[model samples]
Target: MGDLTMYRYDSYDQAIVDARVEEFRDQTQRRLAGQLTEDQFKPLRLMNGLYLQLHAYMLRVAIPYGTLSAAQMRVLGGIARKYDKGYGHFTTRQNLQYNWIKLSDAPDILAELAKVEMHAIQTSGNCIRNISSDQYAGVDAAEVADPRPWAELLRQWSTFHPEFTYLPRKFKIAVIAADEDRSAMRLHDIGLKLVSRDGVIGAEVYAGGGMGRTPMVAPLIRDFVTEDEIVAYLEACLRVYNRYGRRDNKYKARIKILVHEIGVEEYRRQVEEEFAHMRQQGLNPPVEELARIRAFFAPPAYETGLSDKIDRADPAFALWVDRNVAAHKAAGYAIVNISLKPQGGIPGDASAEQMELVADLADRYSLGEIRVTHAQNLVLPHVRKADLPAVWQALEEAGLAEANLDLITDIIACPGLDYCALANARAIPVAQKIAARFADPQRQRDLGELKLKISGCINACGHHHAGHIGILGVDRKGVENYQLLLGGSGAQDASLGQITGPGFSEDGVVEAIEKVTDIYLEQRQDGERFLDTYRRIGMKPFKEAIYG
Candidate 1:
C-alpha cells in the first residue's frame, strides 16, 4: 500500500477506509457527549470549515478541480434537500455549502458525501482548500491548453498534506489556462498561469493575494516554473506562508498580510529557499505520475471543423454572442455563460428543477459537461456552434437564459439581508432595481461590456472589489445606504475599486449607477470597455457627473 505511486480513487476503492469514518464519527459523538464544548468543537469543525455563522451552521464541501459528474450533482442535490433548505450555495472557490445544516447531521452528511467520491477534507483548515482553475479551462479559445490535469495533480498532492495542515490561516490556489484569467487568479493566495515557451509548458506564479477586510492583489514571484518542478515550488511557497504568517491575530494571519508586511521581494526570496530545501528532500511527484493524472482529463472527442459563423439577422443570437458567449479554442464551438440572473431572480441560485435542466442540456448540447463560474454564473463549456439556438431555447424555457452576461443588467449580487443574517442591507432588491433601469436591450448592447457587482456587507460575497462598478450596501442609523466604487476588475489585470464620494439611499443607488454609466458613454474612447474608460478618465469625471 505504501508503494502505490498515485492516490486517486477508482470505482471499487474504498473512500474513507472505514477507520477514518469511524474516527470522525467518534469525534462527533464525543462532542455531543459533552466531552467537548463549542470552543473545543469549533477547531475540529473548522478543520472542515464548518462554521456556525450568524443564522445557521454552514457546511462547505470541497469540489477538487471543480469537476463533477451528473451523478455527483444528484448526490449534492439530495444532500441539500435532506439537510439544508432544499438549496446549496456555490462559492467563488468552486465549492458548495449547505447553510442550514444541523450539528448532529454533519457526520452523517460527511459519510454521505464520501459515498459519492467526495469529502470536505482540508476545506476549512489552515491547509489548502480545493485547487480551482478556469471553469472554461478546456473549452476556451484563448487557452494555451486545458489546465485541469495540473489542477488535479495539485488537488491530490495537497489533500491531507501533513506539513500544511496547521498553517496560520487558510490558503487558496487558482490556475488559469486562458491568456486572460477566467479564474480571478490575482485574488487568490497563489495564482498559476500556464505558459508555453519554446514548445515547453511552464507556469507563471503569483503569491499572497486575497480578499477580506484587507484586500491585496497577489504579486508576481516567478515568471516561470517548469512543469516538473510545480510540486516542489508549491511546497516552498506553503513553507514560507506557514512559517512567517501571523498566528496571534486572526485578522493579521493570512498570507496576504505577510506578503504586504515583508514585501514581495523578501517573500519571494524566502519561498526560493524553501523550494530549494524541498527539492533536496525529493518530495516532488515524478513526471510519470503527472502524466498518469493528466490521462483522466484527456480532451473529449470533438467534431472536426467547427465554424464561427455569425447570423447577423438573428438579434437574440447576436445579443447572446455580444454578451454571454466567449471565444473558444475550437472553431465551431463557444464557451456559453448561462446567466442565473433572470430579471429579478437570485444570482447563482439554481433550483433543483433548474439543475436537472442544466444537466439535461449538458448531456444534449454540451458534451455532458457544465461549469460553475466565479462570476456567479454557469458555463455550458462545449456547446456546438450549430446547437447554440437549441441550447438557448432550452435555457430560456428554464428561466436560465438572461442574455446579459457582462452588461450592466447582469449584476453579480450576494444573498444579502433577505437570506444571510450577516448582511446589513438587502442586495437582491438593489440588484433588481439596477437591472430594471437598464432593461432596454438596445441600450444595454450600446453600452457594451460592463461588470457590476454588489455585496450586502464588506465580507465581499459578491466580489464587489473586482467589479468595474462596485456597489457595497451599508447600514447607517438603521437605514440602508450604498457606497459606489469605480474601476475594479477580476481578470488578469485585477484592481480594487476606488470609493466615490458619499453613499446613496436604496432608491438613489440605481440612479447613481446610471449617472456613472452616462459619464462613461460620454468620455469613453471608440470601442472601449467600462473598466478601460474608467481607468483612462479616472474617478473625477464620474464623481462630477454623478454627485454634481
Candidate 2:
C-alpha cells in the first residue's frame, strides 16, 4: 500500500483502463432496458461526475495535474467536433466539459477518452476529482520546484479510492509551488503549499474550504507534514469530513460548513486523531515511493549559463517578462503566459485553428509541451530568452500574441449566460466590452497589472471572488445586474472581495470599472498595484470615485 503500485495506474498504464469501456457499454444497455431507473443509474453517473443540469447533461473530464499532450488536446478537439457542438469549455478546476453531450453517447465518449488516457472518474461526484497544481509549476521562477508529480501521485491514489467515495459533497485539492499561489489553493477543499523547514521538504496543509451557496476560505490545519505522511494525513482529513460533515441540507454539506459550525480548532483536533490512527496502522506511503514519484519529474536537460538576453533586447518582451514571467528555479529560462483574452476576442474560447497553432508553437519552441492554465490561458513553460522573438512571431501569425498579460485588459471570464444554463447574465460579452474599453495598449500599460474576474452566477466558477476587482452577475427582474467587489486576490495572500456598492446594469458596468481604474491611477503611490493601492487607501476613495 505504500508503493506507487498501490494506485490503480500511472499515465503510461492508463490505456489499460480502456478495457472498462465494454463494461460501461453493457451497463448503459442494461439501464436502457428498463432495468435501471434514474435512482439506479444515478450512482453510476455520480462516479463520473456527470450531472443533469437544468436543461442538458454535462460531462466533466478530469485532467490530471492540468497537463495535456498535443495528442490529448487533439482528442478533446475531436470529441468537441463530433460529440459536442464543436466547442468545449475548460473549467477553473482544471477540468473540461462538453455541455451538449447526450446521455446515450456518454459511454462511447468515456471510451474514447480512455483511449487517450483520460476519464471522468469522480469529476462531478462527492469523491475527489482532478488534483490541480500551478500551470507553470516546474518552470515558474517563483517556484521552489514543480508540484505536478506530487499532484499526479495524489490523482492516482484518490481516483476511485474506496474509503471516501460517498462523501456528502464534492472535494477539490490544489497544490502550488509558486511564491504567490497561482493555483488558487485557498479556494479548494484542501490546499497544499510546498515548503522546506530545517532542510526537510513537506507541505503546509489547509482544509475545509470551497465555494457555492456558502463560500469559505480554507484554514491551515497543519504548518507542515512530512513527505511520507502526506497521503495518510490527507486521508485523515477526508475521513473527518466524511463522518461529521453535514448531509441533511445540500447547502450545509460542504466541509466548509462543517468547519464553520464546529470551529477550525475542533476540526483540527478531530483530524489529528484520525491521522494518529492511520499512522498507527502504518498506512503512510513509503519514502521510496515518494522518491520514485519525484524521479518522473526530474528537470529537463537545460543548457547551462544561458544569458538573460531577452530582458535587454525588446522593451515589449521586457514588459512581458516583468508582468507575465515568474521566477524559475533554472537560469536563462522563463515560464511564459499566453493570454487568451486578446483585445476583443472571447476569453478562454480557443478555436480549432488556434489550438492547432498552439500545438505547432509548442513543438517548435517549447519542447512540445503546453499547459492549460486555470485562469483560461496557455503556458509555454520552458522557453529560452533567445527564442522568445521567434515564438512571439509565430504566436502573432496565429492571432495568439496579445501581450497584455496581467494588465487591465487580460480579464478572466466565464462563458456566462449565453451558454451556461446556471448563468444569470452573459459574462463573455461584459468581458469583451471591458477589454474593448481599455483596448489602447498604452492606456493598459499605464494602468498596470489589474486582475478583473467575473462570474455568471454565484457558483463562482469564474473565480470572481478572488479577483482584484470581482464582478458577480445577477438577474434583477428581467435585466442583468452586476455586483462589484474590491480588494480580493487569488495568490498566496488569498482574500474574498468585499462589495463596493449597489449593482450596476450591463451598460454601466464598464464605466464603473473605468471609474475605479481612474481613481487608482490618480491616487496610487509609485509602483503600487491595484490591489496594493486598495489595501493602503481603503475602498472609500474608490467608492466615491465611482459613485460621486
Candidate 3:
C-alpha cells in the first residue's frame, strides 16, 4: 500500500473477513446449484454488498472513512477490468460499486477485497453502513481533530454487532470534525461533530436526519459526550431505535421517522436511560483501543521547511488550484480534489485506467493515500505544494482535471432508470444536459458554489433534498419529468430544499434551471451566492420567474 498510515488489520480482523468470504463462497455455490431460491439468497447477498439491479448484480466495496491505500485502489481497478465493465461507480457513502458483476463472481471479488483489508460488509443491509467522515479528515486545516479514529472505533463496534445487525431500517452515520460540513453530517441517521472544550475532546450528537420520500434534517440530541463515553451513548441511541422504531412499516422504519414521530426530547430521554444502563455494563471499548486506533492515523512524516509556493502561471492550473485545492493542516502541503464529473460525463463513474492512474498518482504525490469524497470525487490529501503542477498536469492529461468543484456542472446524481431498478426516470441524462448547458468555466465561476443534486426517485440517493438547487426525476404519465427544489443545504446550517412549484420534461427542466440561475443572477445582492440569494428572497422571485 506504499507506506500510507492507516488502520492495519490484525489477525482477528483478517480472520473475520476471511471467514466471511469462505462462508459467502459456500452460499454462492449453494445458490448457483439451486439449493436456495432467489428470495432465500437475496438477504445473504445484500449483507455482502451484492445487489440485484435491473440488469445485473452490483457489488459495493466499502472504503472506510473514505480512506484507501494505493494497493487497495489498484485492486478496485483490477476488479473493474476483470469482473464488471471497464468502470466502477463511487457512491455517496464513499464506497465503490461495480454494476455488471456476476453472482458467481461475487465470492471471488470478496476474496480479492480481503487481500487488501477491505470488504463490503453492512454496505447494503439494515445495519450501520460504512461509517463516513470528512474526505479531508486528518488533513484539513479547519478540523478540531481527525474524525476517522472515532469512525474507525464505530466500525469495530458496529461490525456484526449482534444487537444492531437487523434494525428497523438501514442506518447511516457521518462524523465531521470541522466547522464546515463536507460529509453531510446532519443528513445522516446519526451525525457526530467533534468539539474541544478545555483540552478535552467530545462529540456533539445529532439524531434522526435522513432523505427519502419524507426528508428531515437531524436535530441535536446532546450537546457533548466525552470521547470515552461517546460510543456507549451511540449504542444507547441505536438500542432505543431498535426497541421502539417502527418495524411493521418499511416506509416508517428509518430512525428519522421515529425521531420525528416521537419527538427528539423523548428519544433523548430513552437513549439517556439506556446509556445509563449500558455504562453500568461497561459497553465502551477500553481507552487503549482508541489510543491504538489513533496511532494508525498519525500524521505521515512530512518533510520539513518545504516551500508553500506553487507556480500558478498556467491559467488552467491556477483555476484548478482555485477550485479543487484546499489548505492542508500541514504547511507546504495541499489537499487536491480530483473531479470525476467530466462535462457531460456520468458523475462519479471512473474507468479502470483512471482508477489505476489515480492509484499511481496517490503513490507518487500523496504518500499512497487516497480519499473518496461523499460528492463522488477523489482526494489526494497530502500532496506537496511544489508538486501540484505535475499532479495537475498528469490529471489534465488523464481527463481527471476538471475545475468545477461545487460548480453547477459538478453535479451529484444517482444512476436513475439508466441502471437502478427503483428509479422513476433517468438522472444521468439530466445531469449530462445540465452540465452541457453550463459548460462555460467563467459562467460556472460567476454562478459560484451551487450544489445541484438529482435523484430519480423519492429514495433520495442523489440527496436532492440537500442540494442548493435540487432536481428530482419523476414519472409523469409514463414520461420522464423533473421537479426543481431550492434552498436545501447539507452543511452545518442544514435544511431541506423546497419544491419549486411544479415538474417539467427533461428538456424543459434544463431550461427551468437556466431560468432560475438567470433570476438569481439578476436579483443577487452583494456577496451573495445562488443559495444565499434563494435563502434571502424566500423562493418567491425564482418561482415566479420559472412558472411565469
Best by TM-score: 3
Candidate 1 lDDT tens digits, 1-548: 11111134665335443445556677778898999888988888877657777677888887765666555566777888788888777767777777788888988888887776677776776788888888877766678867888887898788778888888988889988777887789989999999998999999999878876788899999999988999999999998888888999988999999999999999999999888888899988999987887766666777897777756467776777677877777778887888877787767667767767777777777766677777767787777878888888788788887888778887888878876767888888998888888889888878888989899998787888888999898998899989998988889889999999899998898998889989988998998998999999898999998889
lDDT of 2 by residue, 1-548 (tens): 01111123465556545655566677677887878898988777767657676557888887776776665677787888888877677777777777788878989899888876778876777778689888876776666666876787787678668887778988899988757887889889999998888987789999877766677889999999987899999999999999988889877888888888999999999999999999999997777876787776676677798987674466765566666665556688777777788777888766666666776766666666678788878887777877777877777777777878877788888778876778898898999999999998889989887889999999888888889999999999988999999998887878888888999988788999999999899889999999999999999999998789
Q: Which window of 10 residues has the lowest lDDT sum in candidate 1?
A: 1-10
Q: Specify the highest-lDDT model's number.
A: 3
- Sorted by lDDT (best first), the order is 3, 1, 2
Off by over 4 Å in 1: 1-8, 11-14, 17-23, 29-35, 305-314, 419-422
TM for candidate 3 is 0.99
Q: What is each predicted model's overall lDDT from 0 to 1?
A: 0.81, 0.80, 0.94
Return the number of clashes found in candidate 2: 5
Model 3, position 530, has a per-residue lDDT of: 86
lDDT of 1: 0.81
Runs of candidate 2 exceeding 4 Å displacement: 1-16, 27-43, 49-56, 305-307, 311-323
Q: Candidate 2: lDDT over CA atoms?
A: 0.80
lDDT, residue 76, candidate 2: 81
